[model samples]
Target: MAAMKSTLSDAARQVAANALQNTLVDLLGLSLIGKQIHWNVVGSRFRSVHLQLDELVTEVREAADQVAERAATLGVPPDGCPATIASAIALPVPQADWVRDDEAIEIVTEALHIAATRLRKRIEATENSDPVTQDLLISVTAELEKQHWMFASGHAAHAQ
Candidate 1:
């Protein structure tokens, strides 16, 4: 499909593109982290936590695609390079080694929270200049919030 021509001014498109790029980076990082946790999580809750991390990984990857495509529509090249993502991501990198279920839960929850918080700012950043971008970010933010809640709830239950 042909990319949609953006109606936003160059300056506005630049701003929106930056916001989208930032979101894309964070989402990519989150997806990788989710996968890392999925692959390495151990403990009595292994099966459930592993499954949940897979779901989170899928969701974040989808969101990253949407954000990157949106940026492309605005004539911005979306950067998904490892170095770019590593440097631009708002969340801390979890340990590379195997992690227990509780540690995995904390790591993923923190990353999701960071993504959601940044996405909220992006939503506001695009509001006046690019309503469509704002709406897209709003949708992403909503999903991240829901995912965060799901993880948080599970973490609470795991703690008890």
Candidate 2:
């Protein structure tokens, strides 16, 4: 896509770009984590969790692309290198090599919570300087919230 000239001041553009970059990193991290859980989850609920995680991964991938492309459109180079993403993302890595369905839900839900919180902050950061970016973040945040609800709902019946 062609880079578009932004009406916001350079400083504002820089701020928005920074938020976008962070969002991209978080999305990438979440996607990888989801895939990892999808592959390693083994239990009675294995098939269901695996399929749900795959869907989450796909959603995260699309969100990451949207965030990165927005940064590029603003003329800011998005840093999507694996090292950069690993270092920049705030979500914790899962400690266990293999996880049961309950554990996987906890891990994935925590990551989604973190991502959703950060995305909301990014949306706020971009609101005044760039409504378009803020809107994009809002959409992303909404989707993340829905995914979190879905994941949480799966374990709700078992919760004491």
Candidate 3:
């Protein structure tokens, strides 16, 4: 059997792999939560929130693919299996069968906050080990932060 070799030193590859794997888990988990709320959301703001959820899911899914490919580029296999994500994901699971639009916004905002926070840490982790991977993480973090702000601001608008 042949093995993929990474150009990075062992330590650098390890660091990049850890950051990429964790980021993949978070991205996948966020997409799942976004879709859940997309389907279950109800209220005056349902249409807008549903559409926004699709946007969020699309962004995260693309980010996940990039992270996974980055990991493979580093010769580290990305584990995005349901079982792996189930065990590693840190995002809160939605408990309600039907969530109000306001509540959905709050939930999604909170999830994005968690994802962005972890992504910031991953960004820091990869900065010294791999600048190329670090750049990707930075871009992903920016998008997650944007989504977080939008959801949070939407909730505030509804509260007004």
Best prediction by lDDT: 3
Each prediction's whole-model lDDT (CA): 0.88, 0.89, 0.92
Winner on TM-score between 2 and 3 is 3
Candidate 3 positional error at 95, Å: 1.4
Q: lDDT by residue for model 3 over 1-160, one digit each (tens)?
A: 1157888899999999999999999999999999999999999988999999999999999999999999998889899999999899899878759998888998899899999999999899889899999999999999999999899988888789
lDDT of 1 by residue, 1-160 (tens): 2266677787898889889989989899999899888888899899999999888888889988999988888878899999998777779777889899988889888888988998888888888889999998999999899999999999998789
Which of candidates 1 and 3 is the stronger one according to lDDT?
Answer: 3
Badly placed stretches (over 4 Å) of model 3 are 1-3
Candidate 2 at 139: error in angstroms?
A: 0.2
* lDDT of prediction 2: 0.89
Q: Candidate 3: worst 10 consecutive residues by lDDT?
A: 1-10
Question: What's the best-to-worst order under TM-score?
Answer: 3, 1, 2
Q: What local lDDT does model 3 show for residue 86? A: 88
